[model samples]
Target chain A: MINQIRADMYRLTHSWGFYITLGLVVAYSFLITKSKSVGGIMVNGNQDALTRLSRENWTALDGIRGTTMSSSVLMYVLIGLFVIIIGYEFSQQTYKNTLISGISRFQFITAKYVMLLISILITIAAYFATVIAVSLILGRHVGTSWAHLMSTTGITTIAVAFFISIVFSIAILTLIVTNSVVISSILIVIFPLAVATIHIFADWNWLKYIDFFGVSNDVSLGKLTISQFGPYLLTCAIILVVCIGVSLLTIREKEL
Target chain B: MTETILDFNNVSKKFGRFQALDSVSFEIKRGDVYGLIGENGAGKTTIMKLITKLSPLRHGSISLFGETTGHYQQALKRTGAMIESPAAFGNLTVDQNLKVIAKQNGIQSKNAIDDAISFVGLEKKRKTKAKHLSLGQRQRLGLAFAILPHPDFLILDEPINGLDPSGIIEIRKLLYKLNHERQTTILISSHILSELYQVSTKFGFIHHGKFIKQLTKAELDKEKQSGIRLEVNDVAKAAEVLDNAKIKPFSVSNNHSIFVQTNQLDTGKLSQLLIMNGVELNGMTKQEGSLEQYYTTLLKQTDEGEK
Candidate 1:
């Protein structure tokens, strides 16, 4: 298992796509920091909007939230990265090489998952660093209490982790089912867009609670209450588990 | 008694509506260079895939080194294979690609990788990306991957598909060395019957997903039909003389040549008899059936049977 992971990591790190994707994520974060918007909603420099909100100060928590929220679109980049990494195994038939070398199917899948988790953690860290660097360069000030700052960062971290997990799981499941990088990436993009479109046209308020786009929006706006966050986290967790479970089952039965 | 290295027991496979393999059974004994010959879509690759567990076995069992394929990792640990085509990461250099495989198989020594590269004659191209390699070079890399870790059994499907004549000879020599020097059992498939003829100790002929026949080298050589040809001044007189001697000619050609099929016919006695019968013998040659002719005859027989 450790050998498999090492092999995957070597492949990933040696791939130029990994560095390119990381560069794009950092560039996107920098753009979001400069724009002062979370997905194009003006979160800074709008005194009336800030005063209307409960918190009037532009704190580091807001900076982190803005970066994470804007970088949600980086999910596409993440999916594309994994598509190149994992999809190439099937496309080039390298998976058969691994199998012939005595690596089990279960070990193959577990190694990929381990690599994905590591990539997610690296992406999160890159986003945080970009946000901190940009905020410091722009002389942005934090005026919130330390307790509040820590609590808000903790919640935002959890929300980002949940969202990233969902996207990662979806990427993995799509790659497994389709086995074509282009098709898997197309579906990954379409799934979120389809959900957002339905949420917009549907008149039901409950749609926002179950929609991933809605959840991201709520988290970005800092409007998520304990009640709303709990159910959203639970739903995302379930989707993640199901995607992983289905992938494992499908891969076991999959013909090379 | 030689131990069986690989045994397929009544294996059958289906892909949707097409049956790829039908009750195919064969065995490879230790240190034997087994050749699998078949036409396109003849289930050669399917059988290899089943042994490697690239495709799951649904209706039959495959045993490698006496262990069922259910314990494939343990069984495959002593096996190496290059199926269909050479599989390598296009983005990685040859050395890196080999390193990845070595790490996967838990070989920590760099010398092993170096030795494989040298053995395949790819030492100079080790730093080149796999995508940049010519087809023959990639094939060498695939062989390098298969031979690494010194497996007891090596399964190769068309291992020399894209090689030039010298490249083919190189691979043939390498496989021979591995089999004879290292006592490695090899199961190989190739369309080039002539090349297979040079190294294989046994042969298995498959047609339409069936194991039509399997024969040892000696059995095959014995089964092959041979004939004696005579170039004489007068074919008619030679035929008459052969008839008089109760030795019928199998064929009498327009070029004054007669062919006789009989292992017991002595050339010296025939020449003496022809000379005594006043028939001038210009030249006589004995022709042995080649592997190609043997394979064609086998296929023809199978086709006739189907008809």
Candidate 2:
């Protein structure tokens, strides 16, 4: 089990894709915070309005609403990252050899999840650190405090990013099922986009809380007591259970 | 008692209407280099999966190294397998990939990883990204990963499937070394019977999800001894008549040809016998059965089953 976990991490950690994703997340967070600067030169058109937007340059929870467009864009990027991450394993035919090493399917699935979680946590940490470091260097630390990093509220904000992890888990499940990346990625994109859009026009407010995005909203607000919270989490749980079950079944049935 | 390493008793698997493995049973003794050979879409892989317990056996039981499925961890702890194309992480370096498998097997000491790398002959290419490695190298890397735990039983399906001639020879040599030196009981499957014949001590012919026959090298050789070949008209009926006449042969070649060993039957009496049975013995020759002939016969039987 330990060896399999080690192998799982090794399988992922050495890639150009791994480094690139981590780098981009860190760079983007810096950009997001750097854009909040009031001094020196401004690049984008809405700088004046952006500076007024938030005085705190960067905090763990600050990216919750990240640049409106960024919210959707980041989601797209996260989905793509996950789909490719797990999808690449099957595409390259590596899973066939791995399973026969007497490593159980349960171990395979668990190790992958553990590795993906670690990678996501590492990347987001780097992202947030970049934001904080850049803020200090530019003297735009304004309303930010080191307390933000250690706060329960700050930690809870991580729950917002949990949806991306769920997407990744689903991506792995997709890999196990379809065993094809293009199809899995397409389904990932289509289902989310389709569901989110369909929710947009629904008359019932509760229906809006039926996607991963809704669960992220619940976590970001730091309130399970929030009205939209219950159904949102319920939906995420439902999806997770169904996906995990499907993944195990598929792996069991498919010939290695 | 020669220790039995792997035992599949009455195993069967079905996918809806299709049965991929039907009541397959076999056993591999310790120190046996067993070869499981079949055509494409045969149940060789299914057997491998069932041994690993990757796919649950629908109607039978599998035991590895004296331990049944529930206790297979012990059997598996010292086992290595490569059922299909090597499953590896493409982004990681070859060394890193081995390291991962080694670590999974609880070989965390850096020396163990380094040793495995050298074992697979990937030392110089240790840092090379996995995707950059050629097909043969990837296969070797997979081999290294599987054997890292120093298994007593190894199940390899198409271990040399896509390799060049040299790669195939190298792998055959490695398999021989493992079986002889390490005393590993290996069950390997390959489409090319000749490639496997050199190293295999035992052979199992699987067709359309059935292990129709299993024989040791001596048994197979004895079966081939005194073989005779025949070419005549009404091939099917002639073959049937010969079958009914109790003229057991090791193998039958294409186009009504049959191979019987040199001493199995008296040639004069055999030709006279078939002729007397209304089977035109157009061309009769004494012969020996090769591995290819055995494979072809089994494949023909499988084709007949499908029809």
Candidate 3:
């Protein structure tokens, strides 16, 4: 299992697309920190407001929200990276080579999940590094107490982790079902939009509970109460398990 | 008794109501270069896929290296296959692709990858990406992947699909060497019967998802031997003349023709003897059955039977 993960890491890291996406994420995060844009939309079109936003006390919680909000639009970059990484196996028929090399289908799926975990960790580390560098260069001090810092950073980390897990699971499920990079990518984009639209326009009050984007929005902004957080994480976990379960079942029975 | 490397018993597969393989069964023993011959959509790839567990065994069982395919990871650990076209990451170099497979198989030695690349004569092009490779080079890379692990059994589907004559010879020699030196049991499928004829020790003919026939090299050679074909005026008289001359033709047809299954017979003497006996010889030709002819005849027979 470790060997399989190592092999996937070798392939994933060697890809130029991986580096391109990482560069885009870092560059986009840097721009957002400098400009103080929220959700990629500039506020008030006022230069002073941007300056005040950048000059505010940069607590770890603020850093998390800023990084998450700035990087949200670039989620498509993550989707494309995985499309190349996972979808290429089916398109190129290299999955058969792996299976024929004696790796079980379960091992194959686990390796992919591990690869995604490592990628997420790396991205999170880079995001925090950029946040720290920008905050220090701007001469902002950490004003929050240790207890406050711990609670805020912990909650923020859990929220981001859950959000990433949901996205990663969806990306995997899409790739497994479509097995084509183009179609999977299209579905990845269309799925979120469709879900968000239904949740917004539908008259049913229950639609809001199942809205993935709305839950992610609450988590990223640190607006969710403890009660809401538990259910949100539970929903994300259920979706992750279902996606993996369906993928394993489909792959086990799928013809090469 | 020789050990069986691969065994398929009553394997059947279907894709959306179209039967890809129907109760197909065969066994490949150790050191046997089993050639699976068939046309397009004849379930050759399907069988290979089933052995490697690329496709699930829906109706029956497949055993590899004496273990049921239900434990595919264990069964396939000692097996290698290159099904359909060569599968590789186009972005990775040939060397990188080989190393990736080696690492996946948990090989600690780098020499294994190097040896396989050199064996396939890809040393110079090892740094080249798979997408940059020609069709023959890609096929060789696929072969390198299969043999890099030093598997006990190898299954190849259309390994020589697109290759120049020299490329074909190179791959054939490489496979033969692997078999001779390592006693690697191979189940290879190909449409080129002549090329397969040169390497395969055992042959299985599949048509319309069925195993039409399976034979050893000796059996196929016997069917492919050259014979004397004589068309004379009188069937009984020609048989008598040949019998009197001690030729004892292999078979006589209703159209006054005799088939003597021997290339060593003195045709000149037989013709003189026939004319001397007043047997009017209209035509005589030496016919040798080829693998292609045999395969075509087998498919034709199967088609006629279906009709």
Best by lDDT: 1
Q: Residue by residue across A59-139, what tens digits does model 1's lDDT show?
A: 555677666555557677777567655778877888888878887777777677767777766776677677767777887
Off by over 4 Å in 3: A40-61, A143-158, A203-222, A225-227, B229-259, B273-285, B300-307
Q: What lDDT tens digits, residue by residue, belong to model 3 across residues A1-256?
A: 7888878888877888878877877777677666665563211122442354577755545665566544446556677566655778877888888888788778788788767767766665566567657766776655466566556555554555456646777778777877767776776566655665665566666545555445544554556788866766677778878988888998888877
Candidate of highest TM-score: 3
Give model 2's docking category.
Answer: acceptable
Give one digit per residue, the lDDT tens place, for model 3 in B36-121. Answer: 99989999988888888888888998888888867857778899889888989999999899878988898989899989999999
lDDT values of the candidates?
Answer: 0.80, 0.68, 0.78
CA displacement after TM-score superposition, residue A208 of candidate 1 (Å): 4.2
Question: Distance from true position, residue B30, model 2, in Å?
Answer: 1.2
Q: TM-score for model 3?
A: 0.89
Ranking by lDDT: 1, 3, 2
| Per-residue C-alpha lDDT of model 1 across residues B2-67, encoded as one tens digit per residue | 899998999999999899999999999999999999999999999998999888899988999999
Q: Give the alpha carbon lDDT tens digit for every residue of B1-307 in model 2.
A: 9998888899889878888988889888989899998778778887887787666666888888778875676577778888777776766787777776776677757787777677667888888887798988988888888788788888888899778998888888888888888888898998788888888999998877888889999888766434666787656766677678777653555666765544567778877877887878889876556788767766676678778
Candidate 2 residue-wise lDDT, A1-256, digit = tens: 5666566566556556667777776667667766753221111223433354566444333443332213333554555356444566577766655665556777777766666666666665565566557756876533435565445334443554555566666777877877778766766566557665566665455544545544443343344465645566676677777777778778876765
Instruction: Give native contacts recovered, as a fraction, per prediction.
Output: 0.85, 0.64, 0.85
